[model samples]
Target: MAILSSNYSLESTYSLESTYSLDSIGLHTGLIKCPNCGQFHSNAMAPHGHAVWADMPKDTVDLTQDLIKMGVYSSEVVDLAKTLTENQLKVSLSQFFRDSLFERSASRNRLILEQPDLEQPDYELNSSNLVDRLCLEVVQEAGGIQAAFAAAFGDRQGELFENTIKTGKFNRRQFLARVLTVAALIMLTNCQKDNTADLTSDSPNDLAQKLEKNQLKIGFMPVTCATPIIMSQPLGFYEKYGLKVELVKMQNWAQVRDAAIAGELDAYHMIAAMPLAISLGLGSARFPIKLASIENINGNAMTAAIKHKNKVKSAANLKGFTIAIPFIYSMNNLLLRYYLAAGGVNPDRDVKLVVLTPADMVIKLANGEIDAMMCPGPFNQTAVAEKLGFIHILSSEIWPGHPCCCLATGQPWIEENPTTFRALNKAIIDGCNYASQSQHRPEIARAIAAPEYLNQPESLVKAVLTGSFEDGLGNTHNVRDRIDFDPYPWKSFSYWITTQFQRWNLMPSNVDHEAIADEVFLTGLARHLAKKLGQTPPTVILRKEQLKYDQFDPTDPESYLQGQIKKHGF
Candidate 1:
């Protein structure tokens, strides 16, 4: 059941009996009771498999667990464990890596350090070999059949090591050979793990640098909007890039915003407008937040309560109706306004817009507290699945390539830890690519639909992903872009958002939208991030700035704002 086995001596908890000696003459031979079995012995080697973790930290001990998850070996963990005769570069670190009391290094545990480079040795174990032999060998290496028994199999094997010592079969060569065999087995085992992907084609040392950072805390809402960010953890994207991130799920955008402002989170998913909102100080504290990539595109829908589905035939029918949006400064709100305006209903005057968390919106829609919501999926897909609501307008219909959730961080953090930011940027973009492929949608659904993660029905998530599902009106349809992912944070998309922010008067109209867009949406950062890591970053196909509907444009925003129906003045 343990993640690591077979003399997994890399454990942070281990203790071997310490021995001392006093001899006066041949008549006085040192004799002490074996602390292990309470039998008489000379050396203090009697504690027998107690707490001999020595100096290894729990994180160090648990390092191999990630290896098992990633299916790779940690050469760094090995280096920390012990340097054998083969490690010509470093001296015998036996004293440093011993079964003695020492404090585990605090700095080493925060970042998911790089998987070590284990030079595939002179010997290789093919896939056919089971590890039972390796296990027996490790049990023999503690040099005492008794100690090895206790360490490997527990206290059941009584005095076996002692009896073996008496038989004189215990040689230094055999002990050394066993240790090397066990270590080799650990390396080969890593190489054999399932999904043996070489995520970082770079050298192990290069990968180590790419993954350096403190314990990373990334905030996310348990919605499909944060799919790549959340799924990256379970999918090994984070580990591949050298980040040890704890995905903290927040209840609402407000909470996510608050945590980011307070520096409680290192990075997070944001509605495309959040970086601009945070930087302009439109919401809480004025933190200069910057976005590196757009995590998704057109992954949202406008849904109406089941009772109102027949009553609302089109956007114009939504006149005087109440609608919910997840955040005041959200792509949902802006896109909803665009869709509503095009339908001849003034979004600002004809309908009431309220902020609701995606989770809360579903309940409110079901309870009749809200008539409709321009929400993200799989919540949109969920509403349909529960028969609580039906999709009225897919966001893609409004602006086919509209940017939605983004991978954002405080501007200061990026400048301070460029390499670290670059590392994170690469991971998220990689995840975006993985999720973008249709072939991977089913697996992606399984990854994000787990209770600890999205906590939504897998079928709904899968439906949202594949763009094929029941529409809550008894009709079925397939729309491939129902919920899609792309990493480019286009400047034009920011311009569109900026115009909406102005049209809605969320902030002063006088601010420079283009300047703000350039700073907040750094597609350049996303592009250059990989190149910095010694890898050519993938060329981004930014959801083309082409506009199918003539209502919105990145340039010449004033005309679009003027043509809109009733607008906010706040």
Candidate 2:
């Protein structure tokens, strides 16, 4: 019986004429050639009709013969043949006919066993067994045939295959390259699923034993600036690593540094430039320091109150106006100057910068106490929502990319308790990871802006979490980049700060930028924690580069002063 149906496409691989043709071999009996498949088939049916074929057991040949007699075939072999005939049988022939006589014969064919190439002394006694071993290994390595084909053959395999068939040996360079590529790909595939990093050698309690108890008081600002430290302490991560952590809420960065300089606070979150500035005695606290790790990155906003809205339209409009900032040496000051200069204004001469806490700045800005405030998160969001200020500058856009916060301790404290630093670093790293995850961000945001912290509206809290804040110029940024906490703390960021200090004459140019940056910080501690946690600790980390202001020569007083006056609306 020859089957013909319209459901099957004529584009099938088997010749259509053969599909309409009749009896030849045991399996081809009575079937006709299909336009796609030049083979005989049993019964033709519509797409939904399955009357000609019925499922049958693999070992029952009588069932198959009986079905053939009845013009209905359904044994495993006949069903498979019918399936292949009805649809495009796209498969490796070896896999398709695994139970067939041809497959059994091919498996039995062994040139090595028959020819005894094993007589070669160089070949091992098990060399004849290697084919099966190699096939298994290939299956494991390739994951499947498609991967094997893609790796063994180039992406454009048709062309390469033609060339290889023409030549005796396949292109060695291409083959070797593909092999190496496959090997690397397999390694990467295995690495991504690895849970080794998740399993720490020491328990949190054991890790904590490495540190001293209750002695380390860390001063952190109340804003989202100190979030990692806050999250770390409350989450019991600090305790897990043997830290008796007292999270001191400082009013501002200046006070935090003052506490650090005076040996009251062991550590604090600081602008990347703070250590260099402190080492040079540029600020209120002139203490030598050792940075532990990066704390956070890119979350500062400069804003102007509506009361001063008419007074400062752009960076150029703030030439003579007094602006509130946390510290003169902080990124707030540097970034403000950077933006003003970009707008053709010199911050040094044109603007009267008033130092104030971020909270106080918002209050002052709301009441028209200050023209503008360069403040960090949560508060920045509050200020904007309260219409206390329009965004004047966003640090992320100005610098494009850079770590914003560095966890630094007084040099004296680090020297006294090395293990404590390491333990704390691990906890902080854990906290950073926790805070960056999408699932944890909402809770982190709410926790940071809780009643005890900023005590702001939940919406404002969510805004900070989403990194949705306005630049004074009506630009908005949604910051989702993770906070990198476990990296070489003293690297290019310190050098950049040093260079800026020199460029703006914030510090003497001759000072060794490298020495200050390369100072042995607690990066070893961070690495130990990372190794324990199975993460690759950062060897070198540069804070996001500082934004470039409009190119202005600071040396010439005339150019500097005039640039400030004209650009910043002095």
Candidate 3:
């Protein structure tokens, strides 16, 4: 007597790839049988050219109307209607409406009283099989037999249920039965819930399964350098592709680089210079480190306090001033040294180099403790906003376009969990794309402002999200344009690192930099994404190819100067 239906059409060709079909007799019109399941039911399989109760697409609404007439709240009925299918709608509607009929009432009552005899325990059920059990429970609770039959087989409940009963396993009857049972429980409970459960599921195992089993702990030095990776986590890109990312913040690049080399950290928002230093054992560690994904390039700026603004314009103006940088071998040092030398001033003699952390650089500049320092993003924005100082030269202004920050994971982590690496890489790429677009700026800004990381005001967040860089020079520019977001050019950067290693005596003169870069970043999961997405991937720099050291090595002290000359016909 339970009405079931479908949206299938008799005239339409069925996509029988996974079709389920059933047959049943109608309770009301006395039709012995009908094609109620699959294509036939959804396609208007009704008698006398009139549609069966559940044969129509909008049958659920009609059923809700019947429940409303029976004094159910319109809202509550509508809520319940969400669980009801077209056939279930029609069958449930017909049953309740015809409950007033004496003959049908007895039949409905008898059907309920004569519950089917128990069968042999051929099927086993457990927590692992909860979905199947829950499904049946749902069907039974959904108005019991009628609801179950109507929801699954539509008007063909007799045939569908009979077949399923014979099979004694998963079939339309079992699936519908379980679905209705759970839905009915939910409806009767009328449970009020909140986002805590809805937004994030209680299944930690399931959530964890959504990410890679292995871990990659990348470090960041409070500077805005780690923006890409941080942006990826909140964007759900990391989890979508299965990556367990541990973002650790370090106090300085020294710690960041040290942790990376010691394997205490898998990666960090690394300086192009640091990778070179690590690959060659330059400043501290002698271990060769690798670069997987370049996070950003050329947003860094060399800034000075407002009081020293008049004392310096370019490196030439700093003839005798004490200039502060984050560290001795820091990118700030290399860039300033290279730039001052390019401008014809000896970095070792013309300027007294003072070393400090990025945070200290800001404080010192504010307190007039340091003359100028190289800083990035919000810090620079903060300093400039407070009238702290003007930027004598930004990396993007001096170097124009070059790689700056990178997602430098340890070589060992990259070897395992290749899938996870690809996922993380894809997420980082997606996050960068999201961050770059103006329309997505607000979304990215809101995400950064949230508590997970980089908690800042909306305006400040957007300033960085939009890639704006202002060095207090009264000249603000979009820094993203000067950034090579995908700077995986293995040879370009690897050779540069190798040369720095040799220059700083960190690596042997003949150590294969290109081979090391390839082993770390160029191979593995990232390649799959590049192929799948049709992206021109980051090039794997290798030692086999001749190094392009003259083009990028800061140790040459005149590369940028030569670059400026080459571009301007100097």
Assess every candidate by TM-score: 0.62, 0.57, 0.54
Give the Å error, residue 564, model 3. Answer: 12
Using lDDT as the measure, what is the rank order of every candidate, best first? 1, 2, 3
lDDT of 2 by residue, 1-570 (tens): 323222332222122211111111122222322211222333231124444434442222333334445654223323323333212111221222232334455543322222222111111112223333333333334465455455334454344333332231212222222222222222222122212223245565665454444357787777676778887766677766656777777776777677778888777877767766776688554668777777776677777777665666576777777788787777777767767767766677777888888778888887777877877777777777766667765666666555577778776675465556556666677787666666677787777776665667777766766665564445676766522232445355555555556656677647654446545344434554565666655432222233454433211223333464465554
Model 3 residue-pair collision total: 35
The better-scoring model by TM-score among 1 and 3 is 1
Collision pairs in model 1: 13-53, 14-51, 14-52, 14-53, 15-51, 15-52, 36-46, 75-116, 145-161, 146-161
Query: Cα miss at 176, model 1 (Å)?
Result: 67
lDDT of 3 at 203: 46
The total of clashing pairs for model 2 equals 39
Q: RMSD (Cα, Å) of candidate 2?
A: 26.2
Task: Return the top candidate by lDDT.
Answer: 1
What tens digits encode model 1's per-residue C-alpha lDDT throughout 1-570? Answer: 212334344321111100101110110122232211222333211124435424322332232333334433344433322333223111111111221125265421111111212221111111111122322333455564345535434453324333322232322222233232333333233222211123366543455554336358899888887889988999888877667789888889999888888877789889988988998899678888988888999888889999987798887789988899988889898888766776777777788999988888899998999999888888888788788999888888778878899989986565455556666888888888888899998998899999988988899888888999787888898889877887866666877788778876788878575567655666554654434445443332122255444645433455556655333221
Over 1-570, each residue of candidate 3 has an lDDT whose tens digit, in order, gives 122223222111111100111112222342222111101112111245455444433433233234334443333323322223223333333433334334443433211111111110101110122223323433544446456546554566444434433343333333333233222222222121111121133243454453335356767765555667776667765655445677776777778877887788655677766665676566775665655566765667777778876667566777776677776555566666657655666766777788777667778888876677766655666677789987666666655555567766665554444334445666666565555556776686677566556655667656665666565767876755433345343344454544444443445556554445443343323333443445554322221222112344322223433464454332
Prediction 1 global C-alpha lDDT = 0.62
